[model samples]
Target: MQQQVYHSLVYHSQSIQAWEKRWFQQQNSSYGLMQQMAWAISQQLGTLFFRQKIKKIAVCCGQGNNAGDGYLVAKYLKQAGFQVEIYAAEPGSSRDLATAVQEAKQAGLQPYSQFDFQTEYEAYVDALFGIGLNRQLDSNWQDIIYGINRQNGLKISIDIPSGLGANTGQPMPVAIKADYTFTGLGFKAGLFTGQGKEYAGKIELISVIPADTELQPIAQLASHQIQLPKRQTFGHKGSYGHVLVIGGHANMGGAVIMAAEAAFAAGAGKVTIACDAKHHTAILSRAPNIMLRDINALTVEQRIALIQQVDAVCFGMGLGRDEWAKEQYQAWFDLIQNSDLEIVLDADALWFLARQPQILNSKTYATPHSGEAATLLQKGTQEIELDRVAAIHTLQQKYQGQWLLKGSGSLILEEKLYICTAGNAGMGTGGMGDVLAGMIASLKAQFKQKIHLHEIVTLHALAGDELAKNGQRGLQAQDMKHAIYQVVNR
Candidate 1:
């Protein structure tokens, strides 16, 4: 099976349930689907045990089909000469679960309701709750989850960790933290974003349903293999579109410099920086290939003329929320309102826009982290991070343009939501967003005939991942310029 097929399409809990229903209809019984799921889990565990030499195992069983899968795993492990025990967290509630428990007992495996925290198991299986869980775990369950976390073993979750919202990826006050999560049927959207990403480590997709089963995913994970258009050998500097990067107020020249350098690295034909005059000498000394302009001295007419000359514009890296910043923002805003040039808004530009919200008509893209997104939506960062999909939709609907919510799982919302899964923790440093903003503008300028927002976002993140190959710590934004060239040229 192609892993890309599973990685690209992410379905929510509702969609997963609908797909399960389709499978149940095809199989003529829900138990048949359960049996297949059990067989898959047993097969996966068999392979894992053989490779890791895992002998002692414990399965935490709940009341639903998840527990049914656990019981079957224990049965197969026992039959294969492994020391396996079942710790029943809850009584089997549904008929399928009850039948599964009876079958496992008939297979000579006994389940204990009381948990022995001191038991030394090489691996622990979590089947307390899967996609159906919606609420916080109770005190008893929290204790068990905490105990599981304390255990020195391989912690594997069945579908999703217990106490995690299947649709939202927000965990309860406390949730199970699994080292590995084997999701069934389809990949859950919750597993790839938010707190779920931290908890659900090393995801493995278990294909229990037929490949032809129809599942409309809510979002597609950004592909790392997206290729840019080939450049002509006879093309000159003027062949590609020009990009104008406007930002870097006093003492913040590095921001716009990084942006310009990134744009140049991303294959922009001509890159210009309209920044404060204070950094002109430093910028020219470092990056002499970029064109420079004194943003403080440029009149509105000159700004509009600059905007007219460029195919794409990127704004708001280190642009302070001062009177000068407002003037620069307003000048560009007026020109953007009158022109159809591609635009990317980030950092302080987003702050100014949040102060006075308007529906933009031009081809605009907004890149806001959780805090910036919260300010735009007039909500708390916690609220925005809780359900990033909802927050992105809300921001796009209000702003009326493409929005990219930058975080661990950067989400780009244009016609559809796309989750970029390429970046690493090394990208959390400063000036990274500036590089990303410049890259988006450069790609938009070079590919004006189509919408490649998601592609640029993915490329920027993949570049960061490439740079982080050395080490995540002390990874600089400047280190990614070569990586960006490598990704775009590839």
Candidate 2:
């Protein structure tokens, strides 16, 4: 059995099933694995109930193997002297499940008087469905999940929550919101990414069998610890790297200022700002180190000259969606598109890319939150949120570049995939995206191949977490400057 740990591999539901099938094929009793899982779960449940002084628990069982686990858990808990009652959605359909039901009955865990579960208990065990469920739940299942969610008891889900796709992390119309989800077999991708963090709650990975050597994990949970290279004693400003941050419309100078500052905070040797001259004074006032170029005055030849001077460019912060913004976008975008400079496309850059779809180079990084992702993919925000892992992959496939889909579980897809689990709700304020754009531009320019895209993203999230330590409520993106400096130096 695998022990629960943070920052492990995440797999699809099919991989989990494949491992199970292989285990059963070796003449190992499938029923035995079911009992093993239930017993382990029952042990954990007993400890929790004992500590909480919870004596009464309602185990709601469906017709599948998941219900079999529920039935066995009720029996084990009842034997431990808890007031346990079993309620089934239907009779056990599988032979092993039926056997589990009978064994539980033999252990004296009889069915509750009310099958509809009218009576409340100290806690509730959700076993209505598992990873096998992908399609939208019908009215009956939805009603069941809804009723369970309405209950005030401590809710614990067996395996994945009912009505949630094990692959997509999407609730199928409705799903149980568990206080602790004791996921058996392995860590499912849906249980870690997308909306899985909300529904799954605290996760405990239980291994029923050893993973097959052939199975490959879809993504890795981003590590909290990040180590950066130490600065050399002989290094000067030009020895580090130069980052050019483009965008700051006549009305929106603040975006360019934030991005440029973030670049400096992330340890860029030299940072330049290319925006309207109206914003140059403000940019220099806030960050005296940042060189400025008036976006309106720069000719195409000068644009190419500027691109050549910088190792990386962070584009499209605060560039408004207007005629002037569009014209600036076209001139800069075309030059940047044809050039080999490491690029970070964000905000209005993403907007322009959506308007004029282009196959980005491998060196480019595109960061889009759910809303921006919708614009880029021509899908609704809710649709992108439904399955963020899939959305990031889609973005990468459509536009050939490193993609970061920012949300609760920030998905990163470069050559492989990664899910960032470090950020908090406090990092949700305005201008946070600008901060991230700057960080990416600065780091890519400095490190180049010395670092990975996922590492840069994790570092950004870590910076956000550090700022959130004071409090997430009023945390501003501007506050990230100090946090980034603190984290990078460490």
Candidate 3:
């Protein structure tokens, strides 16, 4: 049987609008769809309210179809015997919105122009803004959102939390903090990436329309559960794959040891820790199973010979930014650029690549956090954090390789852009990226192209999540070894 997954298509806001527009052009009624959306939401809300024993509701409406959904939702709830009041924007846009206002009024609910939110209620429905918001919120809008956030109740947003960029996931000055977001039509990419994870609480798809094959998603949510084929009974050590962990200056030994340990834990058959000679004893003491090499002694011919033997190389963990480090990077990066060796550029490797500026081969995978990505793009960390999707794409475009921009919702760009939604905040600890780098190298070496980059990323995240079961607080990256072994075996 095929493994079931929690994967879903994540579309850009523009594509959502285009899909809706196309549906309307096909002779479908826009107002009818709006009503269908509001009705579906009301049904969900009604069930939730009945369970919570909530009777009083405050519906906040703006001058858009998003507000229309709110107006209709208010009308339906009032008809269902729930006490409801509307806090609406004056002179709303669209005939659909005007008709919705009329329907609410006819149903005996009066909409007030200003929303002081002084009157307490059991629930608050945020329909003030939607995916169409392109500009930043001014003081008045910010104040309103701030006020809504201050309220103590079950806060539900209609499509998206108002003020969040539909594609970027950055808040437009401010955004609504919702307990539940009853998103319309389909899933927006913003609800899953960047700051979207913080603002968009418990998301539920309303599915207000049929899926259009013509409309393509901008990204895909990576599945949580992964299935790896069981090993052949006849296979030996070489059958799995050999991974060479390549980095560790004299001053930095733990990174290489941790990475090599992770590689072995992730099922790399034969692993080598090539670092400064000073660290070989420590590595052997820590993991006697790992083979060792001296970074300071290896010549160009020796490096080439070593590269030829390994199935994959994970470079740049704890490789310092000093001149000696630069020399090693220059030698290794030049060879890897020309070879078919599967490689993961990480940590200091990403730092060097930003300066050298080379387009990597198809076999190469580069992983960088927001700060590292900022250096690579010559942009600030703020800009990179503002739009992670764009930064990863830009990295791939510039360097021409598979890229993973590490953050809350880690993005992997390969056959398609993917978001790994599994890991927790505890994975934010130091050395996590090194663990991820090792996992990438090990999996890529064993499975090659049969497994996708996104799968490897998701698997690594799953390991992190497993370790975080105890708690997210002060979780160390070195502690992920057993978790990785358990996940890969499962």
lDDT of each: 0.84, 0.87, 0.89
Ranking by lDDT: 3, 2, 1
Please give each candidate's TM-score. Answer: 0.95, 0.93, 0.95
Give the candidate number with the greatest lDDT. 3
Per-residue lDDT of model 2, residues 345-399, tens digit only: 9999899899999999888999999999999999999988877878888998899
Which pairs of residues clash in candidate 3, taking residues 3 or more apart in a chain or in different chains? none
Model with the higher lDDT, candidate 1 or 3: 3
lDDT of 2 at 449: 72
- 195: Cα error in model 1, Å: 2.1
Worst 10 residues of 3 by lDDT: 1-10
| Clash pairs detected, candidate 1 | none
Candidate 3's C-alpha runs over 4 A off are 1-7
lDDT for 338 (candidate 3) = 82
Candidate 2 lDDT (Cα, 0 to 1): 0.87
**Would you list the rank order by TM-score, best first?**
3, 1, 2
For lDDT, candidate 2 versus 3, the one ahead is 3
Model 3 TM-score, 2 decimals: 0.95
